[model samples]
Target chain A: MKTLVIISHPNILESSSQQFLIKAIPHHFDVTVHHLENEYPDWNINVAKEQKLLSEHDRIIFQFPFYWYSSPALLKHWQDMVYTEDFAFHARGKALRGKEFGLVLSVGINEAEYQAGGREMFSISELTRPFQATAEKLGMTYLKPFSIFQFGYMTDEQRFQLAIHYQQVLTREKDNSLEAKEKWIMEQLTNMDKASLSTDDKIVLENAVESLKNNRHTIDELKLILEQMW
Target chain B: MKTLVIISHPNILESSSQQFLIKAIPHHFDVTVHHLENEYPDWNINVAKEQKLLSEHDRIIFQFPFYWYSSPALLKHWQDMVYTEDFAFHARGKALRGKEFGLVLSVGINEAEYQAGGREMFSISELTRPFQATAEKLGMTYLKPFSIFQFGYMTDEQRFQLAIHYQQVLTREKDNSLEAKEKWIMEQLTNMDKASLSTDDKIVLENAVESLKNNRHTIDELKLILEQMW
Candidate 1:
């Protein structure tokens, strides 16, 4: 899929985390990285240009450092200027409809801090409801957010691993429906068996397939019980 | 209570809803209306001055028209710049501790659209979780948000009534604690009986007092049940 990452960080040049992630994006994929501050230094967003960019992308990722539990000002400003009713939400202007929308956040604190009993007092998912709501209003599929917490504390090796994970997340095509996901898993198992592999690795793959089959059976049983109750 | 309303609308001069709400602020309270866009036209936030303003207020209100399911970009920028860990969150620099924090939002859509089954697919409370989480981190009281929806659809009379309601919400000293609120209600009833002479008004006040008493009784009964179970 054609992906566009709109990065909104006030001091992107100074941010090591963002720089690291930017370099990690796979060169093979058709991806455009649009830096909001760099593009509009004076805060003047060209609506037509932004809408044109949106039209070209199948997946739109809003990437930012989580500032005060949300994205920085420029992203909000971009939304205010670019997403006018005539371009984003009007019946005739549903340009973003059926496109995938996601957030890529780098949080300063530890991941554990964003929980019920934690200092931040709410999960990242709960705090990001605004983004989800926006996607819902625009008729876009809201993808699960990609979060990297405590970037400052991560070692070089850990940072490299995270960057690779991020690239996979951005480029991978996610089939969210249950049936589609199940079919994909089955195809993966079949491919694993056909491919020449070491005995140990083949055993691991077989165990994983067995576990998935058991999980599917359990889910089906639960569904049957729910249907009976209804 | 001393109240500081930080209004962050990029184009406040053109918004009638914001102008009306501004005019309705009660004259009795010590209230400062800080227009962020006008103050920081260059987007250069004076951190010390902003911190000083926050320190002086007992209640800090972030007032804005909801843009992209959140506050305007300038507001987020202000937060990113002004709310440094050394000033807002550090153990030794807990400037916002025990203070009240609230959001005053003017959403373009109807209020009903912000529910689970509605087009918006999330409640206002859910969307505003970031602000609530910020308050929690700062050890500040997170007041229930004051939202005005569909401002463009309201008639002159409706607007006037809403303005009055807005004034009450902004100026009112809300004791969020159940015990404190109950105590305040009882005191109001006592004061009403002593000052009022009209029989109809007196009857209305009496009914309110009776309802409050019943509510208190029910709460006490529930507490007793919980204690017994424990």
Candidate 2:
């Protein structure tokens, strides 16, 4: 699916997580990264341009660093302006109906701080109800939010895993099944540029792909059996 | 108690509810009405000035029309910028600690549209969780939010009642008990401009005040009994 990641940070250059996520867009997935602060320095969001962008994408993500338990001022202003009543909540037709909506949040504090008995005293889900309501009103499918807490504390391996997980959130077929995961991983592997890899690395990659193909075949047979039983 | 009702409306002149609220401050209460849009036409809030105002008030009410299930963008930005770490959440002591925080919301939609099986699908309390969490974090008391729904649909009697109820929300002593309500009503009645009223109206007002004084005395006697029993 084509995805649009709208980044709403006051200072994009200073945010490491924003850079990482922008660079982590899956190679084979059609993605557009629009940074709000960079696009509208004067805080005048062009509604027509934004509406056109929303029309072209099936999955839209609002990516931002959480400020005071919500998005920054510009993003809030953008929502207030661009999502006009006639365009978003029309009686005959909503412009964004049937589109997928999601939030990619980068919080400065640790994840543990956002729970009962924690310092924040509210789950991220509870704090983000407004966005969920907005999606429901517009007849959009709201995806489970992807939150990265304390990105500065992440190790290299963790960062790598986070990138892959982020890509899965963006490109998956709205399923979390092992079959679906394998399908996505297999696609990524098959689309890899092997020209830059060493001979040993290419061999390893080929073995991995072969193993995935066998697993995919076995899963298909199991599904067929289950279908027959039903 | 001193109150700082920070009004955050883009067009204050256009909002009848806002204007009604501005004229609803109690007679004997110390209230400073600061309209953010009027004060900061450039949208740049003076942190030092806001900090000073916050410091001086025992009650801080964020009065605004609900925009997308939260305050307008400027209010969000005000919270973000004015409530800085060194000032609001400092290690030494929070500046606004022990103060009461409340929300005076004016929703354009009907009240019934914000409950289970309704179009909004969330109560005001649930949707305004961020403000509660913020108050908790800063060691302030989060008062029950006061909402005026579809103010334009209200009758003149309803509007007058709203003004009184709005005053009670702003000036009540953080309780909803009958005794507390009586005490507040007594205060307002005692402080009224009786000189402007007709002689018959004056007599009626005096009798009401006399009845309230007796009720207050009786409540005190009951409290004494309960205290002695305890």
Candidate 3:
């Protein structure tokens, strides 16, 4: 499926995770990456160009590091301008209907910090409701988000793994077959026996699952690929 | 009690409800009405000016029409800018603590559109969780939000009444001794008892309660003042 990733980072060049993701985007996949801040530095979003881009793609991903628990200033400006009345919304018909929307989010806080009793005091899901509501209002299908937590302390290996996982989620088929993808993830992880693994082991297993799907290779093959990645 | 009404409407001059509110601000209330869009048309918020303004007041009112279930774009920009680290939060000497934070929100949807099965599919309070969360984080006391509903359909008389009510709420104190405000509202609109009123009505009653506590004016005397407001 054709995918359009709208990167909304204020400064991608200064970001390790964003740059890693940018490097890992496979040229083989039908993908187009649009850097919103680079394109509209002054916050003047071109509504017609944005609407046309949306019409041309089946899957759209909003990639950004969560700032103050939301997207950056440029993305918010894009939402206000490009999603205006009589264009994205009250148009001839619902122009954005049936398009798929997903978020690729990175947060400085760890996973534990996003729970109910966490220091940040709100879950990533709760903080992301505004975007979910936007997708709902625009009649687009909202997918489960891809989150890279505690990005401030990520090791080089962890960053590489995250990029591989992002590539998997981004280039997935847009047809109604994500349940198959979920089952594929379950089978790839070490053993389906969930009670034995520690939290860190589970994350490794999950990332392995994602990488296997993207490369269409087995977990053993993924280990071999990672061994040769450098 | 001193109050700071920070107006965040994009175009206050073109707004009927907001324009009326700005004009009716009482001279004796130590009120300062700020037009956010006019001040920061280029989206460059003066952080020191904003912090100084917050320091000079006991209550900080965010006055704006509800846009996408929250404040407009410029107001969100203000929040992202002025409510920064070392100022609104995490500062050794924080400025926002113990201050009152309230919203004067005007929504286009009617009361019935915000119930469990309403067209909006969420309660007004639920939609406003972000603001509440912001207040909680900044160590500010969140007063009940003042809302004017069904703006697209209200008659001229109703709009005038709304403006009068808006002025009353903006000037209300943060204490609990304003019981007569509730009683007077029930007298004005005898269609329903006070217990069954909507969220918008609750704000007006609370404002009246606040006004009574601060001004020490009888309900009849306040009525006479509003009657001669023109």
TM-score of chain B of each: 0.76, 0.93, 0.74
lDDT, candidate 1, A120-205, per-residue tens? 88899999998888897898999999999888899989987897668656766776678556755565466443456888988888
Candidate 2: Cα lDDT at B203: 91
Error of 2 at A85 (Å): 1.3
Ranking by lDDT: 2, 1, 3
For A139-223, candidate 3 gives per-residue lDDT tens digits of 8898888998877688888877887678667865544465556553454354356677899988987887777566655655767
What DockQ does predicted model 3 obtain? Answer: 0.23
Each prediction's DockQ against the real complex = 0.60, 0.80, 0.23
In candidate 1, list every pair of residues with a backbone clash: none
Sorted by DockQ (best first), the order is: 2, 1, 3
lDDT tens digits, residues B105-150, model 1? 9998888888889888888999999999888878899888999998
Residue pairs clashing, model 2: none
Q: Between 1 and 3, whose TM-score is larger?
A: 1
Clashing pairs in 3: none
Question: Estimated TM-score per prediction?
Answer: 0.76, 0.95, 0.74
Q: What share of the true interface contacts does each candidate keep?
A: 0.95, 0.68, 0.09
- Which has the greatest lDDT? 2
